[model samples]
Target: MNILRSPPVPFTDQASVSERRSNLLDASTISPAGFAWLMLGISVSMMLCGSVTFFIGFMLMPWVIGLLMVFYVAGIVSAISLLGRSIICNALAPPSPRKHIPDNCFFCSSLGFDN
Candidate 1:
């Protein structure tokens, strides 16, 4: 007896091109400096939001407190998602061969390849 096969899911040409571009972007990894900048921005924003929430809570504004709580949770979720994406991108891209070199190595120094 032969097993029946399911039909393939169909996507538009535009969607196929978009999917390819998305894959390529997903495969690409950002530099350490870029990653640092992104993290710094997220951290600063989180801190600012936390401080605002604290101020509103201390001021005894119930509505503001509730709004701040919602905003804080959303921010945390977004930060976690961003971090997950960064990790996945880093994992998908191949590791640099020079990454294993010691800081004091002459080859790494001469080549300026300390990534």
Candidate 2:
């Protein structure tokens, strides 16, 4: 009996489980009016954070633009390098297998092939 093969132990017994459920049933949940006020508070806090972020970005607009431009150029360079590597790999790869053309095919006959 290794620990990995050991059976799981119950966290709580039946009596304690029933007591906890009874306590939860006795507790009062938030009312609709309280929920509405909670939502209003959350919205106000989010708006305040958003306004602060917007002003900070606006104040550092030039630095932000420069950073964005640098990243855009790096992305373009990476894409071009990836395209070149793929093209080189394709060129170096073996030619594809020859297509099977049936002797009775009309398209092959029109192309002037005996096969």
Candidate 3:
């Protein structure tokens, strides 16, 4: 016996109108909390490393301690800047606009239009 296979349907045909629209809108949205957390974790790690280096430098040579201090200060500055930028971006992102279209629009009934 021979088996027959059908061609795959395109994406537009696989989902309802509402679902497709919702997916498009969701794709454009960014997770602000996730960004903030990632920056915070990286900054903390940098500070921890700087502290360890400073201790090691103090044990080896007093002059090396100054270099480590600079490293520590730079790390702190970077952390503060990243955190401030993340907060500002989260605050400034505008709310998602509503999708509107007349029933008579050419692509209103189908997901064939590209914005």
lDDT, each prediction = 0.75, 0.77, 0.73
**Predicted candidate 1 versus true structure: per-residue lDDT over 15-68, tens digit per residue:** 586676665555465667877787898899999999999997788888777999
lDDT, candidate 2, residue 103?
A: 88
What's model 3's lDDT at 57? 71
Q: After superposition, which runs of candidate 3 have C-alpha atoms over 4 Å from their true positions?
A: 1-60, 97-115
Residue clash pairs of candidate 2 = none
Better of 1 and 2 by TM-score: 2
Q: Estimate each model's TM-score.
A: 0.31, 0.37, 0.31
Which of the numbered candidates is closest to the native, going by highest TM-score? Answer: 2
Quote the positional error of residue 73 for candidate 1 in Å: 36
Output the lDDT of residue 46, model 1.
100
lDDT of 3 by residue, 1-115 (tens): 0012232333666678777666655555547776677678889999999999998877889667778999999999999999999999989999788997666676754676534
Top-scoring candidate (lDDT): 2
**Cα RMSD (Å) per model?**
32.8, 14.9, 35.8
Please, what are the lDDT tens digits per residue for candidate 2 over residues 1-115? 1212333344656657666665554443556786688789889999999999999989999998999999999999999999999999999999999997678898878888865
